[model samples]
Target: MNEVAVVKNQILDVEISDLINNGMGLVKINGYPIFVKNALPEEKVQIKITEVKKTYALAEVLVIYQTNPYRVTPKCKIYDQCGGCNLQHLSYKYQLMMKTNFVKEALVRIGKLDVKVNDCIGMQDCWKYRNKTQVPFGVRNNKVIAGFYKENTHEIINMDTCEIQDALADEIVNYMKFLAQKYSIPIYNETEHKGNLRHIIIRKAHVTKEYMVTLVTKEDKLKNENKIIDDLVNKFPQIKSIVQNINPQKTNTILGDKQKVLYGDEYIIDYIGDVKFAISSKSFYQVNPIQTKVLYDQVLKYAELTGNETVIDAYCGIGTIGLYLAQKAKAIYGVEIVSDAIKDAKLNAKLNNFNNAHYEVGKAEDIIKKWQKENIKADLIIVDPPRKGCDSSLLDTIKTMKIPHMIYVSCDPATLARDLNILSDTFNIIEVQPVDMFPHTSHVETVVLMSRK
Candidate 1:
């Protein structure tokens, strides 16, 4: 084993060599790796060791003698306190570069694939692009405070606005906080597991300019529901849905199984290109609608559908991607584990007036095999899975099916690499395109086109 050169709480000066996936700077002391927060590559900084593990030590910047050229002042006042946007200090150009590099490095190091990654596609106007905002409500010093949670803790960093969230949504969040105070609504305490209101979630449809507010509470009953609805609707004439979600459990999950419509409709309408989606409080629509179209357009370009090919959409939530491509394909079959999402998918298909779209509720791994047994083949398969990536059984099923063309949409590069490595035996990667779906953050979205060998 290598000798340790740093001790906990020890202050030392080091030159940063590179940045890790989470935007932390990495430095080496006697060939031992140390991670320093807020330190940039090629920079010299004084840091105090906060933690020392077997192979690595964690540190925080004390003073920076040299800084990277791309570093900039963070826009958010609580950029260091709030954990929402980590790369705000990095210039937008460098943020795109870092995300592209993240995908390329993950492919080579984790997936062991020799593939070229394209530069990340960025938005012209990245701020105020998020269509959804979920903020937890807490009472600090007998006053209601709402915003993002502080880093590494449940403490709330109260803010009136966020750089990435929609401006109107931020306004609605502040209004809700005001109403909570006016009505004396008890804020849920995670420790004591008491109180009434827990979180305030706001959603906006960029295309339709409609809004939805969902109040997550520890109980079904709400204080001054009528006045709250009347005041919010009167204040924001764009609001189309006012909802209350009952989350009686003492857990950390935000939404509950039961939801009630306090006023207006239960859902709001949104559009990506020509395809429309009905977004409920529980729907899994992308937060950034403008970039969602860009990502989907990339998928469409890769698919090159001829309007006569069967397309299988796996892990299809609300039929967003599949429905986007439905008009170009002969038929679309979508499978999801959530029955509600499948129902929404079917509803969205109807909303789009696409008769060729079919949806079923089941695991993708199991459904694909069932389709194979029924001799229902797909000319193209698209999988947009969670961060954990595709199930091993699903990958094996894809291998057995040997679909001619496939597209992998991933939010996590590491998992995308692992799955691509497994599929490499049967598919040849044509290209990879990363989209800046969430700006000023370490997260990235990638689309890969693969052809069966």
Candidate 2:
């Protein structure tokens, strides 16, 4: 519990020994860990301490004396400042290797369970893979600016394009920015919380080429709504839907309860492996469509359905996973807390003629408990929880229910490892597959299959 002997503004030369979870490199001085931004492992770099905490300190890389062979020049112009893509400086091949190692390390160090983690499945064309883009609107120097925020701050980093986002999204955002400026649409002010426009969220279907534009605003109305819609429809012929979301609050949260359809339908159709989905303005569809199919296919494989088992999908947002597995299972029961997503899920199930798939609006744990009390049994359970991993109550229910098979799709390796350790007592870890859903970033999606012992 002793404080590290590090002070602010101190300069020291250190060799990066490892990369941490947040994509920062780690170096130890007197056995005290110091995190250096934009530093690579096995590279010796000169770092300047910015802040010193009780146990660890944060530093910025000043100069790289020795560069790792995997290091590459970042393609982004504001790579040093923008926090959107963290591992762009590292080679794509090494980025996959590092992400695989990150999962393995989390399992071994945190879960204390040594398991074989497969090599990360990367996309052939990693760049321009994102199907969605949500850019905030802000004003800097009396001019409208729209882009991702800077690292660890709300300050917008003005940019023309993003490497990962779909090209159409970039075009739509830029065009919206131009129209906003020309029409004198006021940008939202986070400080005073008084403005008109807040964010521009664009979602594109990779296979369909259909586009949905959602203009997030402070109030329910836009200044020149009709003219703006006319201009947008005239320019973007591929735009299938245009909507306005009103967030009349003083908080930083995007999207509000009220929404109005400006033009076209309220939803845009998208597909993943022949499974159609209706994506609304606030739908929780995957950003990477290609890799999403890969991830879902892996889950289906791990489920090992033999066409007679009943499967339960927890946190089944929009019922994508359950609907994907519906053909293989006898019956699929999906549960989600969000009512909007549940509504979409039910609609999607009917759209696809999936009569066996049923969706309900409720917490996964509470619904599962109710099902268990009603003598409904799940042969297999699919959990695609958020970064915090499965809730303890859900874990307990799964353990008590003794589901034969469990497929866990995790976005955070640390939490997945922790949850896996807790469940290891009853289930045997069969295999772990890491998928590079978000390339050029430290975040990885892992699919783990566990069978009851």
The residue-by-residue lDDT of candidate 1 on 348-419, one tens digit each, is 999999999999899999999899898888999999999999999999999889689999999999999999
Model 1 is weakest, by summed lDDT over 10 consecutive residues, at: 1-10
lDDT of 2 at 359: 80
Error at 331, model 2, angstroms:
0.5
Judge candidate 1 against the unseen true structure and give its global Cα lDDT, from 0 to 1: 0.93
| Candidate 2 global TM-score | 0.98
Q: What is the C-alpha lDDT of each candidate?
A: 0.93, 0.92
Q: Residue by residue across 364-411, what tens digits does model 2's lDDT show? A: 989999989988889999999989998999999999997899999999
User: Candidate 1, TM-score vs. the true structure?
Assistant: 0.98
Candidate 1 Cα RMSD (Å): 1.1
RMSD of every candidate to native, in Å, equals 1.1, 1.0
